[model samples]
Target: MKSESKSQHVGKVTHHELKQTLGTWQLWGIAVGLVISGEYFGWSYGWASAGTLGFVITAVFIAAMYTTFIFSFTELTTSIPHAGGPFAYARHAFGPTGGYLAGAATLVEFVFAPPAIALAIGAYLHVQFPGLEPKHAAMGAYLVFMALNIVGVQIAAAFELCVTLLAIFELLVFMGVVSPGFQWSNFTKGGWSGADTFSMGSFHGMFAAIPFAIWFFLAIEGVAMAAEEAKNPKRSIPIAYVAGILTLVVLAIGVMVFAGAAGDWTKLSNINDPLPQAMKFIVGEHSGWMHMLVWLGLFGLVASFHGIILGYSRQIFALARAGYLPEWLSKVHPRFKTPHRAIIAGGVVGIAAIYSDELIQFGGQTLTANIVTMSVFGAIVMYIISMLSLFKLRRSDPNMERPFRAPLFPFFPAFALVAAVICLATMVYFNFLVAIVFAIFLALGYVYFLLTRHQRETAPTDALLEE
Candidate 1:
C-alpha cells in the first residue's frame, strides 16, 4: 500500500500539460499533412498485389471505410479531446486493458509508418543524386524531421501546413502534366492481377492489397492526437477531420488513377517513386516536369514524416504519463513545451527500423512493403477498438457531453468496425508472418503492462472525463 501510494505520487508530479495553440486551419493542415505522403508513394504498392483495376477497387472500398470511420471517430475525439486519442476513449470505455491495446496499436502504426516514408524519401532523393544511398537519405530524414518536431508544435504545424500545401500543388501539376498521356488501355491492361477479368486470384489479390489501400489515409485520424493542443477542440476537430478526409479521398483517387493511366501501369506498380517514373514516360527523364516532381515530391514525404513525429511523440508522452511506459518519457521540455524525451525515443526506434530495411524481410517483401503491412495491422486493430469504444461509451455514459454525435448512430460506427475487421482478417491471411510480428509486439507490451499494473497511477482520462 505504501509503495502504491508512492507510485501515485510519482505520477502526480510528472508534467503533462501541452500548449493549446492549434486552430482550425492548423488542425486541418496536421490532419491532411499526416497523410499527404500516401498520395506521393506508398499506395502504389497495392497495385503490385492487386492489379491497377483491382487496387482501384480496393482503394474505393477502404476509402468508404475511412469516410465512415472519420465521421464516427470525430465524435469521440471532440468528446474526449485528449492527447492519447483512441487510448483515452478505450480506457474510458473498457478500462486499462483496452487503453493499453489501443495505445500499443497506435504506437505501432505511427512508429512503423515513418520508416516506410523515410525509405520512400530516400528513393526520391536517389533520383536526384545518383551517388547518394537511399538508406542514408532515409536516415537523414529521420534526424532532420525529428529535430523539427522537437523545436515546438506551432513551428512544426506551420511547416506542416506549408509543405502539405506545396505537396498538394505538386500533385495537381503532376496530374495535369500526365493527363495528355493517359490512355484507358494503359490503365486496364492486366488490370486484374494480370488477368483479363476478375477471378478468384483477383479476389485474393484485392484482399491482399488492403494494407496499401489503407496507406492512403492511414494517419488522417492522427489529427485527434492533436486535439488537446487545439484552441477550441470541439469545433476545430470536426471541421478538421471532415474536411481532411474529403480532401484526401479526392486526392488519393486522382493521384492513383492519373498515375496509373499515364503509363504502362504495371511498371509503376512495384516502385516507391511511381509518380515521377510515370511522368518520365510522357515528359522524358530529363524534362523539367520530372525534375520538379523529384524535388517537390519531398514535400509530401516531409509533411507526413514530420507530422507523424509530432504524433508519435504525443502518444509516447501520453502513454508514459499514464504509466504505460517509462515515466521519464513523459517529461515536457521547459522552453519548447514539446515532449522532448518522447520525440527522441520514438526517433531512436524509427532510425533503427530505417537501418533494418535490408536485414528485416518477410516473404520476399521490401522493408517498405513489410512495414506498411505491419503498420496497417496496428491501424486496423486500433480502428476496431475505437469503434467499440464509441459504442461502449454511448451505452455506459449516455449523459456524457458529446459535442458531435456520429450520424446514423450505430450504422456509421458499425460499418467502420466491420470494415476494419474484414481488412484485418484479409491482411492477416495474406501477410501472416508480419501479422505474427505485430502480435508479438503487442503481446510484449501487454506483458509489461500486466507486470506494472499495480504501480500505475489513475489515468488522466478520469480527470478529463469529469470535466
Candidate 2:
C-alpha cells in the first residue's frame, strides 16, 4: 500500500554509526550512578510507615525481587543489545504495540526519577547554606547538569564514574564515623509499632514501604538503555548490572541499620539526608564530619542526577528513532555524538514536573513522593512486560544467541514478575492519586501515538533478524 511505503521513508542507522565509546567501568558508572542517590534519601520514607523492623522486612523482599530480575534481564540486554532496552525486547518479541507500551513505561521511569534527586540535591545544599532555598537550588541543579550532558557523553560518563566512586567512598566513611555511636537500643526502642509484637498497622505499613524500598535500587535497570554506545555491551553490561545491584543491597542495609542506630529512628524518617542527620549524633552539627558529608554527599546526588539524565535522554532518543515520539528527538549531535535534543527534552519535562504540583496541590502529597511512586508504577509495568518478553522469546526464537543465560531460568524471572505485580498493586491501592496520574500520563501518550502511528516512518533496529 502507498501508506506502508510512505511510512518506510523513516530510516535506520547502522550500529557503527552510533559511536561505541563506553567500557566496563563507564557502564558500571552509569548503572550504579543512576541509583546511588537512592542510598541517600527516600528509603527513610519507609520508616514513616513501617518502623525499622517493618521497613527492613519490606526492603528484604524488594531486594530479592531486584536480585532475581537483574539476572534474567541481563539475558535480554545482552542478546538484543539495543538502546531501547525493554522497548526493543518487547517489540522483537511481540510487535509495535508492545514496544510502544514498554517504551512509555521506560519513559515514565527515567523521566520522573531525576527531579526527585534534584529536590534532594537542593535540600542538601539548603541545609548547608541558610540563604539558598531548596526549590531554587533544585532548578539550578537541573540547569547545570543538563548543560554538562549536552556538552558530551564521554565527559558525562567520566564524571559519572568519579562521582560514583566518591559516593561509594562517602558511604564507607559514613559507616566508619557512625559505628561508634551505633547502639542496639536505638534500633529496638521503636522497632515495632502499635504492638510489642506484630500489629496489623505494621503489616500494612510494610507493603506501604514497598515504593520506598524500591527507591534504593530504582534506576539500576537504566544501564541497558546505553547499549548502543557501549564499546562491548556483551561483556560490560552483565558485570555492571550484577556488581551495581550487589553494591546497592549492601549499602542499603548498612545505611538503614546504622542510621537507625545512630539517632532516634523516627526523627530520621522522611528527611532529605538521613545519613548527614544521623552523623550529628556523634560529630556535632558544626563538626568536620557534618561538613564533609554535606559537600561530598552532593556527589551521590550528582551521580544519580547526571546519570539518569543520560538514561532518559537515551530513552527519548530511542523512542523517537522508533517512531514512538517525534523524529527530531532521535538525532545525535554532530559535535558531541550525543542525543542533545533528547537530553534537553527530558530536562524540560523534569523541571515542569518539579513545579507542576506546586501550582495544583494534591492531597498534601509532596512532589517528590508522587513522582517516586509514579516512576515505580512505570517500573512495575516494564518488569512484567520485559519478563513476558523473555518467556515469549524463548518460545518464539529458540535459536537466538544469548551470551549470558539466567542461572535459574524461568524461576528467577517468574518470581520477579510476581513480586513486581504485588508491588504494582500495593502502589495503586495505597497511592491511588499518583496511580491515577500515571494512568492519565500513559493514556495521553498512547492517544498521541495512536494518532501518529500510521504516519510514522521507522524500521525495527534489528530488522536483519527477521530478514
Candidate 3:
C-alpha cells in the first residue's frame, strides 16, 4: 500500500524466480494467443471510419510498421531478455524514472486489454448460446483463465499453444468456407458509410481507423516478457517473435479480405463479435454449423484472454518486484511458483473495467470504445519508448550481445517510432475523452510513486506474503 524508489539494480534484491518452462513454439503461442482475438473482433471497428478497402490499406500500412519494429524490438529482447519487457529495457537505457513510466504504460496496455477481450468472449458466448448473459460469461472467463495461469506456466503455455492453433485453424476454415460466396461487389457497396470515398473526410476516417487496424498486431511484443521463462531466451525468443508477427500478418489480411468479400462488410464492422456475424452467411443464422462456428471462434478470444492474463501478471510482478508498485503485488505463491498476488490484482481491475460503464453510467456510450482507445494509448506509449531504448542501448551499451540484429538498424526502428507517435496523436484527436481518463490514471500512479519512494521493501513484502 506504500510507494518506494525503484531498486538501484532492478531485480537485484527480489529476483524473479519464475520457472523457465517455455520453448520457441510455446512462446509463439503466447505471442499469437495474446493477439488472436484482434482478428476476431476489434478490426471491424476500422470499417466505421474507413471502407473495406480503406481498412485494408490501413492494415497493410500498420503491418509494415510492426514488421520493422518487431525486427528491431527482438534485438533488444534478445540482448536484455527479462520479464519486465519494456520496463527492463527502459531502465537500462533511460534510468529509473523512465523505467517507471515504461512499466506503468505497459501495465496500462496489458491490464486494460483483457477486460475488452473478456467482454468479447462474453459476446461470443452469448452469440452462440442466447441463454448465457455476456457479463456473467466475462466474469467466469476471468476466474477460469486466472486459475489456469496460476496452475503452472508450462501447463498454461501448452494450453495457449493448443487454443492458438485452434484459433488459427478456425480462421483458415472461415476463409475456405466463405470463399465460395465471395463477391468483390459486396466489399464496396455501402462499405464506405459515414465518410466520403474520395474526399478529405475519407482521409480523416482512414486516420481514425488506424488504432483498430493496429489491433491485429497489438501486444504481439508481449512475447518478449516471457523471455525470462523461455528455456533458451537467446535462441528461442527471436524465432518466436519473428514467427508470431508473420503468422498474425497473414491471418489479419486473410480474415479481413474474405470476411468483407462475403457480405456487406459494414455489418461486421464496429461490432464486438464480427467473426461469428460474418459466418452467419455460410450457414443460415439458426443452423447447427453456424452455432458450431460461433462456439469455435470463442477460442480466439480465449487464447488472448488467457495469454494476456499471463502477460500482465508478469509485468505486474516485474513492476512490484522492482518497487514501482505495491510490494505485495510482487509476492509469488510459494507452491504455484507464480505471481498469484499480481494475477489477482490485475483480474480485479479487469472485472471492474468490464462493468465500468454500468458502474459510472458514462452516458449512453458503451465502455468498449473508451477502453480500446485507452489501451491503444498505452500501447503507443510503450512502442515509442521501446524503440527509443533500442537506439539508446546500441549507442550506450555497445557490448550488448544481440543474437538477432535488426536488418536495417536505425531506419526500421526510427520509422516505427515516428509512425507510432502519429498513431497516438490520431487516437487522441478522435478519442480525447478516453485519453483524458487515461492521463488521469497515469498521473495518479506517478503521485503514488512519488509519495512512497522510501518504503522498506522487505518488511512490507514479507507482511503481504504472510497474508
lDDT of each: 0.87, 0.85, 0.82
Which 10 consecutive residues of model 2 have the lowest summed lDDT?
Answer: 1-10
lDDT of 3 at 385: 95
Give the per-residue lDDT of model 1 (tens digit) for 2-69.
12213344334335788999999999999999999989877887888799999989999999999999
For residue 204, what is the lDDT in candidate 1? 84
Q: Look at candidate 3 and give me any clashing residue pairs.
A: 3-452, 4-452
- Model 3 — TM-score against the truth? 0.92
- Candidate 3 lDDT tens digits, 248-349: 999999998888888877778767777667878766688776676777888898999899999999999888876677778877888878888889999999
* Candidate 3 displacement at residue 362 in angstroms: 3.5
lDDT of 3: 0.82
Candidate 2 residue-wise lDDT, 47-139, digit = tens: 888888888899999999999999999999999888889988987787767877899999999998888889888887887797998878999
lDDT (C-alpha) at residue 299 in model 1 = 93
TM-score of each: 0.95, 0.95, 0.92
